[model samples]
Target: MGDLTFEDVTVRYGSRRRGVTAVDRVRLTVPAGAVVGLVGESGSGKSTLARAAVGLTPVTGGRILLGGRPLPRPGRAGPRPLQMVFQDPYSSLDPRMTVGESIAEAVARDVARGATARRAEVTRLLELVGLADERAERYPAELSGGQRQRVALARALAGRPEVIIADEITSALDVSIQGTVLNLVRDLRRRMRLSMLFISHNLAVVRYVSDIVAVMYLGRIVEYGPVDQVLGDPRHPYTRELLAAAPDLRAVGSDLAHVGSDVGDGTPTGSAIAVGADRVRIALADVEPADPHHPPSGCRFHPRCPIGPMVHPDREICRLTEPDPEPHQHRAACHFAATVETAPVTPARRSR
Candidate 1:
C-alpha cells in the first residue's frame, strides 16, 4: 500500500463567471496500509475528492500525490497505482465482455501477458474476491448485483493498485448483500495490507471499515481524527447532529433528545418550555442553506447553527470570522467548539 495525500486540493466546475467550488483547499492524507472513511451528506464533495485521488477529475488548484509522487497525466503510457470501485458496478463494467474477459483485460493493461497467463491471473483475482473460477464466464446482467460488484472488485485487484478508492460500492445492493461485500473488503484489506479511501453517507458502514474518520460539510472538513475519538466524542456540532440523527439502540449511550421546533405566526415554538412558561425556539428554520457560489461571510454553518449568540453571550466571533481547523485532542473547525458546553440547548420554563 502507498500513501495518498491531497495537498490543498481545490476543484471547481464551470467557468469563473458562473462556477461551483466542489472541494476547497482540502488537506488530508491517507497513510500506507490504512483505511480512511470520509462521511458527509449529499453534495458535500466527498465523491469529488475521491475522484481527484484517482485522477478522474480535474483539480482547479493544488495537487494529488501517491507515495509522495505527483500523479501522472491521465494519458500517460504506464500502469497507475490507484484503482477505484464505483457505486454502480453495472455501469462501470463492460456489458459486452464476460466477467473473466474484463478481469483479463485489466491484467493485460497492467502487465504484458499471453492469453493463458492472463486467464490464470484472472482466476487468482477471482479467488481473492471470494468468487469461483467458473463464475468469470457470467455476464454483468446475468449475475446478481452483489456478484457484479464482486467482479468489479476483482477487476480492480487485477491492476495490483497500491490504493483503492471505494466510493459507495455497496450502496445499490440489499442490506444483507452489503454486509457480505463489506466483510469481503475488510478481509481483503487486512490480508493485502491495502490502503483505501472509503466514502459513504452511512456513518455505521463507515465506522465499520475505517480506522480514521473525516467529517465533511459544504466542501470543508469540519472534524477529523481517529474513528473512536471523532465519532465517540464528536467536537463539531454538525458531527453531533449527524450521529444523533442516526440512533443505534445496540450501542451504549447513543440516544440524543430531539431539540427541534416548529415555525408559525412569526414566532418559533419548541418542545421545551422557556421562561414565563412560554415555548420559545431558536429560529433554525429561518437559516437558509448556503449557496455554494456565494457562501457566507464567516462560518458557513453559522446561519443554521442553533447554539451561538442566541444561547451564549458575546459570541459574535462566529459571525465575524471563520475558525481555522484546530488540532487539539481532535481537529475541529469552530470558534466556540471548546465553549460549546456553555451554550444553551433546552432552557427550563418558569412557573407562571
Candidate 2:
C-alpha cells in the first residue's frame, strides 16, 4: 500500500499554445519503504514533480497513484496520504503560531482526542524529530534554522502520511547542520519505514540518502536506477558529466582524472548540434541547453551530448528520432546507451 507511482506524468505551465513544459511524461516509482532521490539542475523540474504529486502543481497529463489508487485532492477531510517537507522552513512555518499549536492542528485532523491527548501527541512528534518539549512553547521565530526545519518535518509527519516528498530539506542549512538533518531524516525513515522522494542538486547527498536515483535534465528523467548502478557506473553522458564535476576524494593522487583539453572548434553556439568535431567535444561543457519551449527535434540531450559526434551507429538517428526510455542495465533516455555501456573505458593518464 506504500507504492507511489508516476505513470507517464506530465506537467506544463501556461496555455497549451504558449505553455512551458516543465515535466515531460516522467514515469517513476518509489516503492514502499524506499527512498528515491531526484537530482537535477534548478530548472530541471524536480520540485515540480513533487509539487504535482501532492496536487500543489497541476498534472497536465497521466496520473500519480498512491498505493495503486489515485491521489485524493488536498483538504478532502481525512488524513492526507502524502505530505511534503519543503526546502524553506521559515516561510512554511507560521511565525505567530507556537510550535505546539501548529503540530496540534495537524494532529487534530485525525485525532479526536482532547487538548491533553493532543499535547501528548505533539510532544511525541517533537521528540520524534529530536526536539525538546520546551521548544514546543516557542514561536517559529524563536527556533534556529535547523530547529525550524525539524519542526516542518514533524508537522509533515503529524499527518502520518504514507509518502513524504522531501524537497531539499537540507539545502538551506549549514554543512554541519545539514549532516544533522540528514541523519535525522535517515533515522526517521528507518524507524517509520516511510516511502520518500528526496530531491536535491547535491549529488553526494543524493548518493548517500537514496536507494534508487533519478537524474533529471530540462524536464525529463535522463537516467534512473539503483543508487550504486546509476552513480557508480553511470551510462548517461549528463550523469557522467555531473559525476566528473563532483570532487572525488579518491582522485587526489590517482591517474583516474576525467580532465582533458577542449577538442572541438568551440565555435558552435546555441543548442544546435555540431557534426564536424572529429573527437569527443565534451559537449555539455560548452553548449547552452535548449529552451524548454523549443526542445531539440530528436533527442533532448543531443545538442549537448559529448559523444554524439563520436558514436557512429546512432549519431544520425539521434538527430532525427527521439529515443524511447530504454531500460537495459538501467533506464536511460539516450539512443547510444548500449554503445555507452559496452564502450571501453578510457585509460587513466599519469598524473604529471
Candidate 3:
C-alpha cells in the first residue's frame, strides 16, 4: 500500500478577486519505499504540493493521508512524519547554530531521543550524508554550498521520516556535487527504506531518481505513470515536451539536436493532435486563453490545443466543457489522450 495519498487536493491563495489556485484537483499515491518524481516547469505547482504534504502550505481543499489515515493539520500535529529539503540549502540552515547542534536539535524534537543519543545520532547522520564527523562542529557559514546542502539533508534525515519531500534540492549545486548528493539520497533510501517525493524541473535528474514520474503543467498533472513507461513512451504532449527539453549527451553532434517544436502563443498543432484512435477530439477554437488570475472556460488546454472537430467522448459536449482525467492505467488530464498518437519527434523548434 502507498505510504501517502493526495485525494482531490486543491490549494488557492487569497479572496475571490485575488485568488489563484496553485494546485487544482491533484491526486497522487506515493507507495512505500518508492521514489516519486514531481516534474514540471516553474509555476507548475511542484513546490506548493510539497509544502501541502508537510502542512507547510494550508490545503485550500481536499485531504492528505499518511498510512491510510488523515494527516493532522499543521501545528496541531506536532512534528510532521515527513521532512522537506529546500532548494536553497544556504538559506534553509541556521547561520547561528553549528551543524552538529542543528542536527541534534532536530533529532531531539522529532525522534524524541535524549541529548546523549541525539549527539550520537548527529554524528551518524552527518556521516550518512557524506560529511566528515569533524565538519559537524562548523557553522553553516563555514561550509561550502554542497556541504551546507549535505548538512541540511542530514538534519532532515535526523527525523528518520518515512517520507522526504526534496524540493529541487540539487538544482543549486555544481553538476559534480549534484551527482554525489543524488547517489547519497539513493543509498540512504535503500538503507532506510524511505518513500520520497522528489520535486525538480530537471527531467534527467527526475528520470534518474524516480521510480514513478508525474508531469505537471500550470498547476495540474498533465501526465502520470511509471518512470520507464512515461519516459520511454510518453503519452502526453507536455510530458513529451519535457523529455525533449532534457539534454541528451548521445545527441551532442547528431542531427537530433533539437527535440520538440516551440508552441509560441500557446497554440498547439502538428504532433500535439493525437491521431489513430476513436477518442473524442477537443479543438482549440472552443476555448479561451489561460489567465493566471482567471483561467479560461472549458478545457484549460484548449486555447493552445491543435486538435479539431472533436467532441467530448463521454459527455458528447464541446471543448467548452472540462474533461475528467483519463481512467487508464496511466492517467492524463487531456480528454483526447487515448486517441492521440505520440510521435518520436516532438514539434518544438531546435535550439541552435
Candidate 4:
C-alpha cells in the first residue's frame, strides 16, 4: 500500500465547453495504510473520483498520484499498482466462468509461474477471503451475494495492488451480509495494511472503518479531516446538514408539528413554506442541486446554501464569490463556514 493523492484532480465528460464535470479540482489524500471514507449524495461524484483513480475514467485536468508518482497509462505490463472492487459483484464477476478461473486470470504470472502454482495461489486467495477452496470451482450464479463480493475482492488482491478503491462494495448486500463484508474489510486492512479509498453514502459505515473522511458535493470536496474531528465537530454547513438528517437524529430529539402555510392561493410554491417543521430539509434553500453542465456563477451551492443569500439577502458576497476549501484543522469549502452555527437563521412566517 502507498499514499494515494488526488492532486487538484478534475474529470470531465464531453467537450470542454459542453461537458459535465464529474470531479472538479478535488484535492484529497489517502495516506499509506489508511482507509479514507469518501461520502456524498448519489450524483456528487464520489464514484467518478474512484473510477478515475483506477483508470476506468479519464482525467480531464490535474493528476492522481500514487506514492507521489503519476499513475501509469492503462494497459501497461505486469500487475496493476491500483485495483478496484465495484459496487455490484454480480455484474463485476463473469457468470460464465468459475470463480477459480476468474481469480486465476488476475494472478500475476510472476506470482504463479505454473499451472499447479496458479491453482495453489487461487486456493490460498479463496481461503484468505474465508471461502473454501472447493467453492472456487463454482460459478457466480451458484454463490450467495456475499460470496461473489468476496471473490471480487480476492481477484483484486491477486494483482497485489498498492492501493485499493472500494466503491460502495457493501451497499448492495443485506444488512447482515454488509456487516460481514465490513468486518472482513477491517480485518484485511489490519492484516495487509492496504491503502483504500472507500466510497459510500452511509455515514455509519464510513465512521466505522475510516480514519479520515472527505465529503464531496456537486463534484467538489466540501470538507475533509480526521473522521472524529470532521464528523464529531463538523465545520462545513453541508456536513452539519448531513449529520442533522441522519436516521437516528430523531431518536434523541422531539418532532415538531408543521407550521406555516402556502403563501398564495393555497398552492405549494417554492416560497410558500415559510418555516419548515424541521431544519434538516435544507429549509432555507429547498432547491434541487444545480446542473453541473451549467453550474452557478459564484458558489456552486449558493442556490441551496442554508446560510447564504437564501437566508440573508444582504449577504450578497456568497452569490458573487466562490470559496476555496483552504486547508485547516477541519477543511471546508465555504465562506461563512465558521459562523454557520453562530448566526442561525430561524425562518419567519411569510406575511399573509
Report the number of the highest-lDDT candidate.
Answer: 4
> Among these predicted structures, which one has the highest TM-score?
4
Candidate 2 global CA lDDT score: 0.77
Give the clashing pairs for model 1. Answer: none
Model 4: per-residue Cα lDDT over 103-215, one tens digit each: 99999998999999999999999988889999988999999999999999999999989888999998998866776787788778889998999999976667766889999
Q: Estimate candidate 2's RMSD in Å.
A: 8.7
Q: Output the better candidate (2/4) by lDDT.
A: 4
Candidate 4 TM-score, C-alpha based:
0.87
Global lDDT of each candidate:
0.75, 0.77, 0.73, 0.79
After superposing candidate 1, which stretches have Cα over 4 Å from the reference? 108-112, 249-286, 309-313, 342-352
For candidate 2, lDDT tens digit of each residue in 264-327?
2211111111122222334454678789998887878788787674345457777888777775
State model 3's lDDT: 0.73
Residue 78 C-alpha lDDT in model 1: 72
**Cα RMSDs, all models:** 9.4, 8.7, 7.4, 9.9
Model 3 misplaced stretches (Cα beyond 4 Å): 109-113, 249-289, 308-318, 346-352
- How many clashing residue pairs appear in each of the predictions shown? 0, 0, 9, 0
Worst 10 residues of 2 by lDDT: 266-275
TM-scores, one per candidate: 0.85, 0.86, 0.83, 0.87
**C-alpha-based local distance difference test score of model 4:** 0.79
lDDT of 3 by residue, 1-352 (tens): 3479999899999897889998998888889999999998788789999999988899988899999999876777355678899999989988998999888877845455577777788889988888899997899999988889899988998877778999999899877677667767777877888899999887666765678888887777878887766766666655655655555512221211122222122222233222222221224334544675776556665555544223334433425676667777677777666665654553223466
Residue 248 in candidate 3 has what lDDT?
A: 51
Q: Model 3 reaches what TM-score against the true structure? A: 0.83
Error of 4 at 233 (Å): 1.1
